[model samples]
Every structure is written in C-alpha cells, then in structure tokens.
Target: MENAFLNSLVVGAVLLGCAVFSALAGDPDALFDFIVPPGVMPANVSANNFTFRATKADFVAGKLIVQKISLAELPTLDGAGVSMATLMFPPSVADPVHFHQRASELLQVTSGSLFVSFIDSLGRRFDQKLFAGDAFLFPKGMLHYQINLDPKKPAHAVAVFGSSNPGIVLLGPTLFGSGLNVEVLHQSFNISKETIEKLVAANTPHPL
Candidate 1:
C-alpha cells in the first residue's frame, strides 16, 4: 500500500511540474511535445517614395510639402548622372519647357487640377488637362511642361523619374545655344528657313 501511494505521489508531482512549466511559457501548447510557438511579429515596411494626404493646415504658402523619401539628394543623383526633383506648382503656376534626355518621366496627380503639354521630336504637340485622380506618361527626350489650372486652389502631382539620377535638358537651351545652327532644324523639320530663323531669333538668350 505504501508503494502504490508513493507511485501516485510521483505521478502527481510530475503533472504539477508540467503545469507550472506551461504557465511560465505563456502559451497553451507549451507542454505539448509536437507544438511549436510562432515567431516574433514582423517589422512595418514603408516605401522609398510615397505620399500621404495632408490636411488644410499642412498647406503653407500655397504649397504642400510632400516628403521626398528618395534615397539621396538631387545633386548626389546628378553626380551619378541622374537627378529628380519633386516639383510642386501652386495654382496658376506654369513650369518651364523641359525634357529628360536620358530617361522618361511618369506623373500622377493626387489632388487638384494639372495641365500637361508635350512636344514630340516630330514637332507634334499633345496637351492634357487632368483632375484630382488623373495620370500621364511622358516619353524620354520630349519637351514637356506641367501647369496648375485652378486659380484659387493648389495642385499636387508626383513625378517619378526613370533614371537612378536623371537630369533635365531644357529644349530651348539645346536649340538656341551650343552652336546648333538654325538651318539644320529648318531642313530636318520641313519648316520654312525664314520661320526657323525667326524662331531661333525669338528663343535667343534662353533662361536658366
């Protein structure tokens, strides 16, 4: 009888030790031999380039500052022979005629009115007026501009440059300067020589 009582006591102590270990483990299946605990929670991942909505208070001086989440600054990108700038044009603002010689640009308007114009190598011009949720793609080496149409409210658009570091080559700057003779354009584009001369003359002294 003592032996049986001691056997029962040993069994009860073993079960109690298992229960205590399970309580300390903080999982229901801690005592189970085949059950494994899950791993830790994952870290939150964000974008290299992203934009979140800003309230009215966020807009200062008619411009809403969108965080550039780019990996590096514009000049660093330029030194690698590429650069991109986050351009924010307030209402009724007009951007200069620009082109990316090395890469294309993709634009998406998150809010307000945006007007885009582009002139192709063949001298064909395309203009588009977009609203709050519109997007456009501009081909590389083409002249393009973005303007805000609304006079009272601001417009916000995001431009993703194709190159790791892309630079802008203004169209007039190339045509007017660098000793690119006007006659070449007249002969290539099938425009009148007089017209070409007049155009070059008008665009002389291009702005930086």
Candidate 2:
C-alpha cells in the first residue's frame, strides 16, 4: 500500500504539478483544479463566519453528477482538515479507477449498494460489496474504483476526506485521454496497437 501510494504520488506530480502550481498562483485559466488547498482564508464575507451549509446542488451540475465539497465550496473548511463528496450511481454505472493525491477516503453508503475495490502496493486487490450504512476506507493515493451493481435502483454514497482538499486522478483519463504518448502506453502495458487505439478512442474526451 505504501509503495502504491508513493507511485501514485509520482504519477500525479508528473501529470498535475502544473495544476498545483496554477492553483497556488490563482491562475483562472487552469484546465481544472488540482486542489482548492486549505489554509487560505476567504475574504470580503459578512461578519458571520460561524457556519456554512452545503447540499448536493452546491457541488453537482445536473442529474449526472459526482460531486465534492472542499475549501472551494465552503471556505470555513479552510484549516478544518476535512471535506465531503458524494457518489450517485445510476444502475450499472461505474465510477472507475481513480485515486486521491492528498488524503485517505472514508466512504459510507447512504442508499442502495455498490461494490468497491482498491489495489495495494504488492498488487493485492482488496474489495467489498457494501450495502447502505456500510463504510470502506481507501488510503491516500491508492488506485481504487466503485460500481453500482444493481439492475434497478440507483446507489449513493458519501465520502469524507482527511484533507480539506483532496484531488482526484483518474486512470482512464490519465492513460488514454490525457495526451500521454501512444508508444509509451503501448510499451508499458505490452498491449497491441489496435487495442491501445481502441481504448484511447473510447476514453477520448469531448467538450460539453
């Protein structure tokens, strides 16, 4: 697990180091936020700095959503060492392989159920089927994924992170859609060119 975490950090740094720099520099042109890092206080708000509230809408876009609330959503969370996110899975939908660069995740099912798994340093996979009220932990930087296996009802889970801002690194996007060279992927996975091109095509991103 430790080694896996370290490897993930290296990959994240290689891919997203500029994202981190841009966020710190407050560059609005960043492709996406790597982290809304904590400890920076919010400015120009009303005197009432006592509390904050957030609902799914605060973090979600539409019916199709996987959302998180960090310092970006609630400035009060700055320095609080905590953040929350939600996973809403339509039946048979997958929230595929991904990792958090900064914090461990503790996720609790709130509706329906899902199967979750993580791969450790030694390549040993740990997985579980969780029903509502069940919880699982994935240590920081461990590659992991979740799937809603049900055929009918939707599933939902809530996750809490140990850091105020935990950024995600997704495997599919990183490998197939992020513009990593084809030769590198072909050699690393030792897969055929046809298969590689198919995966790249499947994962290619299109603007909304």
Candidate 3:
C-alpha cells in the first residue's frame, strides 16, 4: 500500500510538471504532442533560453500570502516545466473552498498544522489534519479547502501544481459574485431571491 501511494505521488508530480511546462510555453494544446512515434528523434529542448523569478502576493483577506513560480516569471522552464507556490496562513485563517480546473495540486506542510477537506466526484467528503512534514494531494477539479488549525501560530505549506496556469474558481465568489441572473441562481439553488441577494452582498470584496 505504501509503495503504491509513493508511486502515485511520483506519477502525479511528473504529470503536473509536464502540464505546467506546456501551459507556460503558451502551447497548452501541445500537451500530448511529445509522444512521438518510434524512430523519431524527440525535439531538442533546453531550459537555458530564459530566466525566472519567484513572485509573492497577498490574498485579499490579509490572512494569507502566496509566493509563486511560473513561466511568466521564469521563462527558463521552457523545456522542463513546472509551477510551485508557498502559502503562509496566519492563525485561525481559512483558505476558502476552491478548485483548479487544469491541474492537480500537491501540498506539503512545513510548519504548524492544517485542517484540509475535499469533496470527491461522488459527493463523498474526505477530511484530514496535516502537521509539519505531512503532505496532501488535491486531485484536479476537486473542491478543496484548508484552515490553519493553530490559533496562536501560523501555518506554512508548499504547493506544486500540474499546470502553469492552473485556473482557480472559488466557490463563494463564483456563485455569489459572478453577476449571473439572480433569478437564475434563485431557481437553481432553490433559495429565495432575498437570500440570494444577501449572499451576494456578503461576498462582495470579502469572500472569507
């Protein structure tokens, strides 16, 4: 069982690395083009053509900051493509429910603790508490969230994604602030119009 899990992790990492590389190269459509037929020399590619820098940004909630690496900031990954980010969450803060449409994610906790949860395709939910040195995987397109379990200390984790442009859709913002027809939402959610309005109001510029 342990060996299988480790093998899966390795496979996931390789897939993510390839996806990130392709997306960064602005050739997402070429994701599977590397599988050349026999007797063909693979295209010669190298990571020496460009440079890369890690960039940092603060989340809107002010409780978290993420430092990221991608092709945009590091063009040198043209051949060997991958993307990564380091997330720092302050005490008692939560990373809201969201999903990456294009990439699976691997997270490694370096400090403190985190409570992670996700819902699978069958609507079954899985939850785990991760401490320092622990790792978690969020499969592509799965809805997942995390919370800092420590009230006095901060939590830190490193995240690796399969795609350079792994798109993120936050549940609350997408549902409440997307500017879709309120009546449509009311009908779809089976909720009153007034409740939809209230939810839209609460999510404005403050999803947490």
Candidate 4:
C-alpha cells in the first residue's frame, strides 16, 4: 500500500507539472502529444506524407482571405505541433477580430503594408503599421486583427503557428451569428434589440 501510494503521488506530480508547463507555454497539446500516450504512432511516418505544397489557390485574394494548412488538411502534421496559413487582404479590407485557441501567430508581411493590432487580457490594445518584410506576433488567445491600408492594392502575409491545430474563434461571428439570444446580447453590449438582430443577421453565414 505504501508503494502504490508513492507511485500515485509521483504520477500526480508529473501531471501537475505538465499542466503548469502547458499553461505557461500556451500549448495545451503538449500534455498528450509530448508524452505519446498509448496507441499514438509517430506522425509523417510515410515518405509521401513528408512534403506539403502550396498552390495559387492557397494565395487567392478576397475581402479577407485566409488559406490555412493545418492538421485538418494534412494529417501528417498531427504530431508536428506546427502549421501555416496564407493571408491576403484586399484593398481597404480587414481580417475579422479573432483569437487562436492553441497557438500564437507570427504574421510576416510579404507585400504591401498592413495595420495590425491586438488586445491583451487586461483589455489594453496595441497597434502598429507593418510594411513589407515586417512581422507581428499575436500572443496566444488574444484578440487580433489586420487591415490593408493601401487603397488600391492588396496586402499579403503568411502566418506561422506553433500548433498543428490552432483553432480560430472570430469575435463577431461567435457573438452575433451563433444563435445567441437577443436578450443576452442586448444586456451584454447595451445595444438596442433591433441593432443586435441586424448584427446577427449580417454576421450569420449563408448556406453555400
């Protein structure tokens, strides 16, 4: 009984250490991924899975285009803990305010310029204008956005993430388009019911 208790204590301490490390690193995937719990095989074992290619469509431009190459698109990246996305912002367009759940993003401007900003947990906002070859880091789980300041040309960038499955949570869509009750929004934002409904209607995605 004493031996069993000591083993359990060690296991508990290890788990607690992992949890604290993951929280500090903003990488919850580390807990299960690093230890390689039972039945988990090594990623990208097959030679064919070793390569990834980006095509023209990946860089296609739109209002606020984001073509991501995450674990969902490449199963080989399942254990890699890394992913990338292409960003194209059309003239005067802006990427929606969003946050990555699992990974911080490093956005590097490739062409044109962009106005970038992020809001920290304390609600303090930071912003800057990034030109070609400039980069910005958005801390994990912080709300961030970027806008193409050029009036006639589009801006391009690439975002590198530290997690294979970095999940995006868009503020507008989450708030207005998720069938949230009108009363909830009205109370939260102190906005009129009509305005809230209009926002919901505008943000709701149409069946494609």
How many residue pairs clash in all the candidates, one count each? 4, 1, 4, 0
Q: Give the lowest summed-lDDT range of ten residues in model 1.
A: 33-42
lDDT of 1 by residue, 1-208 (tens): 9999999999999999999965543213223222121231223222321233333435456553544423244212322222344556677776668886656778888888888999998899999998877888888778899888788888777777656434567666567554567678877789898887776776756443
In order of appearance, the predictions have TM-scores of: 0.49, 0.70, 0.69, 0.78
Local distance difference test scores for all models? 0.64, 0.77, 0.77, 0.83
* Model 3 per-residue lDDT at 163: 69
lDDT of 4 at 148: 91
Off by over 4 Å in 2: 1-64, 205-208
The prediction achieving the highest lDDT against the true structure is 4
Per-residue CA lDDT of model 4 for 111-186, tens digit only, reads 9999999999899999999999999999999999999978889888999998888888988888898888999999
Encode model 2's per-residue lDDT on 1-208: one tens digit a residue. 9999999999988879888764553213324323233543544444344345545353232233567777667765655667888878887887878898877899999999999999988999999999999999999889998888887778889999977767788788678987778899999999998899989988965221
Query: What is the C-alpha local distance difference test score of candidate 1?
Result: 0.64
The TM-score ranking, best first, is: 4, 2, 3, 1
RMSD of each: 22.4, 11.2, 10.3, 7.6
Per-residue lDDT tens digits for candidate 3, residues 11-109, read 999999999876664324445523333333456433333334455555444477777675455544333335778899988888899997767889999
Instruction: Give the runs in model 4 whose Cα sits over 4 Å from its true position.
Output: 1-45, 58-62, 205-208
lDDT of 4: 0.83
Candidate 1 or 2, higher TM-score?
A: 2
